[model samples]
Target: MTSISMAGTGSGLVLTASWQDTVPATLTVRAPGQGDGATPERPLVEVLTSRHGRDWAGPRYVATSVGQRLRYRSHELTSSGSWQTLSLTQTDAVTGLDVTSYLSIHDEHLAVRSWTSLYNNASEPVTLHAVSSLMFGDFGAADIDQMYLLRGRSDWLAEGRWSRERLRDAGLPDLTTPGRPFRTRGCIEASSLSSWPTAQELPTAVIGDDSTGTHWSFQIEHNGGWLWQVGEVPDGLYLALFGPTDEHHGWQLELLPGATFESVPVSLAIEGDGTLDAITGFRRASRAPGGGPGLPVVFNDYMNTVMGDPSADVLHPLIDAAADSGAEYFVIDAGWYADNGDWWDAVGEWQPSTRRFPGGIGEVLEHIRRRGMVPGLWLEPEVVGTNSPMALKLPDAAFLQRGGERVTEHGRYHLDFSSVQAVDHLNEVVDRLVNDLGVGYFKFDYNIRAGVGSDSVAASAGHGLLRHNLAYLAWIDSLRQRHPQLMLENCASGGMRQDFATVSRFDLQSTSDQEDLYAYAPIAASAPMLILPEQAANWAYPQPDMTDDAIAFTLCTAILGRLYLSGWLDKLSDDQRLMVAAAVRAHRELRDSIPHCLPFWPTGLPRWTDQWISLGLRDVGGDALYLTVWRRDTEPGQVDLTLPPAPDGMRWDYPSAVFPVESPLRIEGEPSGGTLRIVDVRGSHAARVVKLRSVPVE
Candidate 1:
């Protein structure tokens, strides 16, 4: 009378575990296609695979009641010869409560991805019209956490900490519609509360909620090559099935065949410290050697290449300069492709510009290596210019076209990702660059979106984006699988694609190449809110008339965090480089050690004058917290800095600097309501990141 037992055989049993626990006493089976001649027997796809993979057999199921939830188990009724593995158990390892309904696990290409689906399934529809109820996560939590909400409708706060309502959208509009396509697709994940419980902390009970039905896709990033996703399914119970979307040959997501009303896949787990099913056979991940966090610097640093400068030496100085300045990456930009055009004759070409690289790209790379930096190259991957060679060589139907002309923008045309053949072609392109060239990084840009009247139109909104991004994922995963070491930065006209989905898929965000005129609020909010501050549009090549002070302030804003130094670092004086160097070093060292990052000093002001300012950072030790305060200009006002959370009974110190004088500010010794006040900060900029120290007592 063991808890675990197998039935008839292990063939249809997709997966099985080595027997251990007792299966439930009673087993219930249902049909997914209820009325139209479907059987009482489970559907052909319901067969469960033991966590051990093909080694064991399980049951296949179909929902008889459509949206009804049911449970089953193996016991006296269930035969003996059955084996079970802990990883795929549908039953509780300890009590065997038939947790299958709450979770689903399946094998797709040997890797098991979990999917979790929640449904109101009762009568009417509900509008999740609130901001707090969104899923927000970036590199650690980057994309729009709140499923693609109605563009200008509700608003969201930093990583969903505290949010107001949103009033506009950067994309097109249809304001009257319900939840826009692409909502929550992931089950609730472990809380991102900024504090790690322990090194081996297992998920006790992680979950996701969407009172308002948005898009049905969410992914919890595992490694660089894999993630979990929910497949298309009608709002139903037990119909929730999940399988790893498999990133082997190319990007793939389980697209539900319309006939079924059940969600094909859902996120679930059975064993271990709650990890994804053991992934196997992916030993081919590509590597770029000298594995590190990744290259975090400039892309296409060649102006001559852009301007048709034939001398490879043109890039020599720039690459060499970037290398010396601690820049980790340098991209060759546009002109390297062999071709002709206003945008670059090489638009359709994917080959190296041998003439431009007079000494060969190998020599240019060797130079960069000598200077101590990684090399990143740019590729539209999914875009091709109509006038380029690849376009002429490729058949007309190979691209996404409009009325007559090739529908495109940003000087390029879209690749028909819907074709497997197209994907294969791109794969070959990736292999040559990543494996053959030893290129360490890429700046993948999507300059145009697929407009109407294209055969490349996706079957589903989610699938459309899925296929579009899938191409890149496949290339990167293949590289990672083969190399297991490298970085891929995703860019779409700067911050255009700066959402969590894209961020989670890549390592960096371009955050727009334009000068951050409204840099204060967004970057200030974005630094700790999403991508690292260093990835923000930090440094820029100013126009001739821009003042030096503006550049200095911009530089200062950038230096305060993970700085991204673009523009002409060479054009600036030695003082500028030294200042940036010090800032970069300080940030690199203090990044993890500091708590919240502040991109801009707050505007000093009394209660209602303009607004109050508060910037605080908790030391990694949790005992110390540093706060920088700002007072509004002109108007005489007192601004308060409310202290952040801290461990109880920890002795803390308060220090302050006001208009040329540094002094000690009083610590009120409170939590939420605590405040630091400064009066009449006239002509005094709210610039401060001073230190405050304390050690927590055990």
Candidate 2:
């Protein structure tokens, strides 16, 4: 028996998934009003499992699961405002073990969040090999030529590097080839059981067809041990999302009778248009819930300026300057916890260094409070320095261990949040910092990865890491619950721990640790590809001696997102100070519209060394738009930006003083929309933020 149901997502998309006794179960999405009423034949969701007594499939670890052989049991549907959930249950014909998949959709963004659960319905215990958080059916037309896959790559300094590839060019053999059964090949994955999850790659991808404006984007929401795959199948391509699959990460689970295991969560967005639509859909769907503090301008003393060395004499002037410059939160990042100059290995104590502070850190905190800025501190909670007393005092279970030996990386031991002692220790540290010290913001930093993870008490190293990740999220939730006013920023040595799982919980995300303002341009321009603009805390660390063009360039980098000011603010000349202040004032004017606007790039994704780049945010109601353009080199520094169709005579304003243009400007109207012929009017390494207002056409 089989059943099919369709629901409109209110955003021009229709989601449909079906299950049948003879056919495999799957979920698919399509643009409504275009396709016939008949249900699409491909299922996007795939599930694979292993039973002790059954015949083996392909690989003990990576065998793909097709739902055709399973027995369809039942399903349920529930709805709330703009959101709906579809839960389906299927059982293995031979073992009676059941798998239930939950697919939740929100109409506001035409997006879906999915996860799976394994239930031991049988009388005996069952060992499971794998469960997927999400699996996607191929989108776009039958011909693969129009299909392209988008992937984001990241590193310590070079972050948010995105590239596009044609699906057929991926060289996957055609599944429709005669007598050739399709074989899945080569998967692009980003896995981090280690501390730096985004160090190598971002857990996000997009599939789009150029010929047809259809696109699909998905992101895995796990802080540790995540894997997503794109492979070719018989009818179309498929995407598989899981956390630490057994083949790569050595993960497995045992479910005793009546026991259950829930897979990690994944979110997917379906848009009827281009890459920008998909990206905007993701941002709207995965944003942090309301009740947190508003995103404000922050000043940190660690990037390119202070470099973590802070004392009373060093910080007092900076705090005064930051407060004067309109920074709302002043964060003293790193090196405040230890008196010793070499403070990396002396962490875990989290005590303010009296030697560094001299008059005590509280004096500085009081000064910041008096200056009308919130006080923030840097903390690395997941590690205990080898030299710290807690390393020796805590039980073996408190720290990550392989067999009986504790795992050490980069002069620190990874703390296992699954252990009560570890959680309690971190809780105490946070409570003390938030309560006793009157701290309102925290910049949480993670510096190292634990490699494959600890093998303490779990089925596998991957299993142990998964347990710890969940526990860590739970701890963070509890902290937020205890202190609802506290704002937490997630950083793994800067922008490495980026994912929806962490992004949804925290208030802000550090975009990068790159100190060079010139080199940081592409990173800031490309940030909206992965993070919400309001939550992307990009650093605007303009040095005192930098040229006006250079200063404007760096300030523009931070203004689009959460402005993170650093560098020597007190030493800036009057002219330089005015430029910085103008950037901040511009950001404040643009901040309110940021939460409701959708991001789009006029010239597409920025290259690492692109001479010209543009990022645009337009309101959904078509009333206004904010565009930032950066010119890196002295070459052609000109771009003709064509905005989405807007009312005629839209007002355009630019601050020529800050963003001096060397070229003449020409404005024209085209069939596509209004065109800004912004000619050679800017110095090299300069930028401008243009505000466009739409007035009713008379």
Identify the leading candidate in terms of TM-score.
2
lDDT of 1: 0.38
Model 1 misplaced regions, further than 4 Å: 1-291, 294-314, 338-341, 344-348, 354-357, 396-411, 435-437, 452-468, 517-521, 527-552, 559-561, 592-638, 651-673, 676-691, 696-698
lDDT of 1 by residue, 645-670 (tens): 34576544555321113322222332
Clashes (backbone N, CA, C under 3 Å), per candidate, total 78, 14
> Residue 79: error of model 1 in Å?
25
lDDT of each: 0.38, 0.75
TM-score result, candidate 2: 0.93
Of the candidates shown, which would achieve the greatest lDDT relative to the real structure?
2
Residue-level error in angstroms, candidate 2, position 214: 0.8
* Model 1 residue-pair collision total: 78
Instruction: Determine the backbone clash count of candidate 2.
Output: 14
Root-mean-square deviation of Cα positions for candidate 2 versus the true structure, in angstroms: 3.0
